[model samples]
Structures are given as C-alpha cells and as structure tokens.
Target: MFTTTAGKPLRYNHWRKSYFDSAVSAAGLADVTPHDLRAPHGTWVADRYGVMTAAHRLGTRTRA
Candidate 1:
C-alpha cells in the first residue's frame, strides 16, 4: 500500500538517500538511513539464528 507523494506505487530501488534524508528530517529522527538498518538486521538474524532462518523470514526456501 506504499505510494510516493506523486501517487505512484513505491518500488524498492526508486528512492535514494536524498529521498530518505528528507523523510528522516521530517520524522525528526536524530540520524538513520536505510542501509544502516538493513545490514544489522541481516547480520543479527543470521548470527543469532542461521542463514536458513533469515531466508525463511525473507520468504526464501532453503535449497539442498
């Protein structure tokens, strides 16, 4: 249900740091970016659980 201000459906790669920077400023978060959040999420899940668990959370199947 995500859409841009232009009323177009939001796609993952469409937004860049400039877009996120504006959003973060509007939201008044001290400092955070998309890459900052995504990396640790992957690392934490994989480190604590395993690759298979991470893949499952991301809706991918473990292959033989």
Candidate 2:
C-alpha cells in the first residue's frame, strides 16, 4: 500500500508531475508515464488467456 510522508495511507489525491518525472528519469525510463506501467501486464495477460478473461481477472469491465 502507498503512504504519505506523515505515515498515513495514501487515499485519493493527485501527485505533482515533477515528482513522477523525477522518479521516471531516475529509473532511466524515458517517456514513460505512471499509467504506462499497466500496459505490459494487460497485454501479456490478454495474449496468454484472452481479452475477456484478462479483463475479468483485472477487475475491469469491457464490452468486448
């Protein structure tokens, strides 16, 4: 689970872009956003199983 510096569980809140940009740059991932982390897992699962099954396992509802 994510937490703040004050030792409280991180609930809903927006983080600054500079914060994410610095982390990404430090990790040496160029042009990567926080949201990009999910794409590889999603694609791997979907390709291995199926789109519908992967969506269900991911707890996401998809029409197709």
Identify the candidate with maximal TM-score: 2
Model 1: CA > 4 A from native:
1-31, 60-64
Give the per-residue lDDT digits (tens) of candidate 2, residues 1-64.
Answer: 7777887776543343637777888888798866686778878999999888778877798674
- Per-residue lDDT of candidate 1, residues 4-55 (tens digit): 8999988766775548777878888857868677667877898999987877
Off by over 4 Å in 2: 4-6, 11-23, 57-59, 62-64
The TM-score, computed over Cα atoms with residue i paired to residue i, of candidate 2 is 0.45
Give the TM-score of each candidate: 0.38, 0.45
* Clashes (candidate 1): 0
Error of 2 at 31 (Å): 3.1
